[model samples]
Target: MSGTIQFKQDLPPKGGYEPIRYKRNLPARGPGGLAVFGGILAICAYGFYKVGQGNLEQRELKRERAWSRIHLIPLLMAESDRDIYRREQAQLAREKELMKDVPGWEAGKSVYNNKRYNPQNFVVM
Candidate 1:
């Protein structure tokens, strides 16, 4: 189809024709947006890795504490028992020393220094 239509009136000549300098209307985008997004993603990934690492460390520490408790309980009980035995032995030695000064002390009744009045023998006023 090569049919062309001719205008009867002459058209005015176009004056001061300014061509478009740029093709796209959008502003120039540098690597700033991509760099910022990449930086945020990297930070998030690092935080996630740290959280996982901390959980593993916490679990390891708990396991070690449990193991220490399991192994030290028997030793601690034995040490407590030894301390009690030593205290009893010391008390027995002191009692023996005190008894050495008196002859036939066990044969006599045990005496207590009673300073207070006997409440059991209270008389009705």
Candidate 2:
């Protein structure tokens, strides 16, 4: 036993605790390396490129459909209007023939409104 008890704090050895050994000490056993990292990066890049291409293609298809609707809608509306006018004309001719004996029944006369051309809509639906 010492006459006076002494307390000594533990200290690192020389060379500052062997440079701390901060790097991983596990064995290089996994299937990973620079080559694997590079391959994974390349695969991710390709996947992103394919996704971008698909998005672009989808956008183009949507644009085409939109343009087609823009061009066709008016033509379809005109054709439908023409068909309605033709049917009305046919009905007027039948009425003129059937009501030949009756008078004051004017054919192709506006009964509801005085406007010759009714207002049309431009909705996409």
Candidate 3:
């Protein structure tokens, strides 16, 4: 009977259990120290990775710009040549018309004869 005896409580504290004494700011238990070290290492690695990526991106942009400049040189030369050819054609046409009106040349023809077409005066783009 004594071994089987039990105690029962009819009321409980209003605010639950409390400790009369405890240690303050004890060194954290578990793997907290390892977790903090790992976290710092991960942050540093990420920062370095981002820096490397930025450098690579900058180099790629510079390479692309160089390629664009190289490609544009040929295009500019071709455009200037085309403009010159068109101007030459216009000059030849004017000469042919002048030869046809040699006997009956008008004042308008004389006025236009002094004005010549210049390739450099035109904009390609």
Candidate 4:
């Protein structure tokens, strides 16, 4: 009822103004963006390296196969030559047996007689 402000007996105590104490808990920043980019680059580089290694292996395998074929070619040729020589030897043996009992039909004479007799039988126009 007086000119000055008055409070009731049960009013709360008045204290000096105090700023709010805000505890800023920083968030956990995950792996850096640059680190992720670097990891991707490393993976790509490793993939390329593996591809190059595979190509090299393929080339080496091709070379080995080519060399094996090259080595086999000479063996094949030698076998063919041996077969031809055997055939010639068998032919000569057969010719010897055929003319063995023939009189005056020796190895050289038989070949010469065949050539000369065939020409004589052919009439010239």
Candidate 5:
């Protein structure tokens, strides 16, 4: 009878029971630190290379533009000088007609301010 005796509320074991989802889980290993750093460095190097190429291309374009402007300067000056010469010729003709009855005065001749006043002077931009 003593051996067969049982308590009304059966107690659990001394060690606690494990949870239901107790399967063994192994943590996944990621990429090594050196490999990750190398990948990041490669990306940065590619970005810098592209930027340098763009800067070089822009510099070439700017140089071409400056050279073109330099080449056109003489032509622009010539055209301007031609226009000024035509205007002076017209002014001289008008002055000769108007002052014909009057005495010895020239059209484009100035006693003073004559050092660089002619249309032959090359105007620079």
Candidate 6:
């Protein structure tokens, strides 16, 4: 007998190992990770939206201020005229009262002599 050893194969031919396949049924929001991600996204979106809204409000306020400035001259003049008219009316009323008391007293002098005409005594209300 030769000094070589030979064995007969009775088993089937061997092949490389095949990877195992498994069905994945994991939820999209597993372990709250998706929920946390969504929350972060929502926070960032809201922040951006608030910034945009603030910018819009600031722009509107600036525009209103500019508009008011442009129209302020006429409004101020009208207000001054109205104040003057009121002052004249008040003087006339004081003169009428003084005329009823003194036959020939001027209304302007009566108003000037009235203690209530003191600037300190004038209350806006």
Best by TM-score: 5
Q: Relative to the unseen true structure, what is the C-alpha lDDT of residue 120 in candidate 3, on a scale of 0 to 100?
A: 43
Best by lDDT: 5
Taking the tens digit of each residue's C-alpha lDDT, what string does model 2 give over 1-125? 76596788798877666555677788877677987999999999999999999999999999999998999999999999898777766776876787778788775555557677653332111
RMSD of each: 14.9, 10.1, 10.0, 13.6, 6.4, 11.5
Residue-level lDDT of model 5, residues 27-51, one tens digit each, is 8589888999999999999999999
Give the CA lDDT, 0 to 100, for residue 41 in model 3.
97
TM-score of each: 0.44, 0.43, 0.39, 0.42, 0.55, 0.34
lDDT tens per residue, model 3, 38-122: 9999999999999999999999999999999998999999998898788766765766665665776542233344577433433
Give every collision pair in model 1. Answer: none
What's the lDDT for candidate 4? Answer: 0.73
Query: On a 0 to 1 TM-score scale, where does candidate 1 land against the true structure?
Result: 0.44
lDDT of 1 at 93: 69
lDDT tens readout by residue for model 6, 84-115: 77977776686576577776666554336556
TM-score-based ranking, best first? 5, 1, 2, 4, 3, 6
As a whole number from 0 to 100, the lDDT of residue 101 in candidate 6 is: 77
| Model 6 alpha-carbon drift over 4 Å, by segment | 1-35, 38-49, 52-56, 59-66, 79-106, 109-125
After superposing all C-alphas onto the true structure, candidate 4 shows an RMSD in angstroms of 13.6
Poorest stretch of ten by lDDT in candidate 2: 116-125
lDDT of 4 at 84: 66
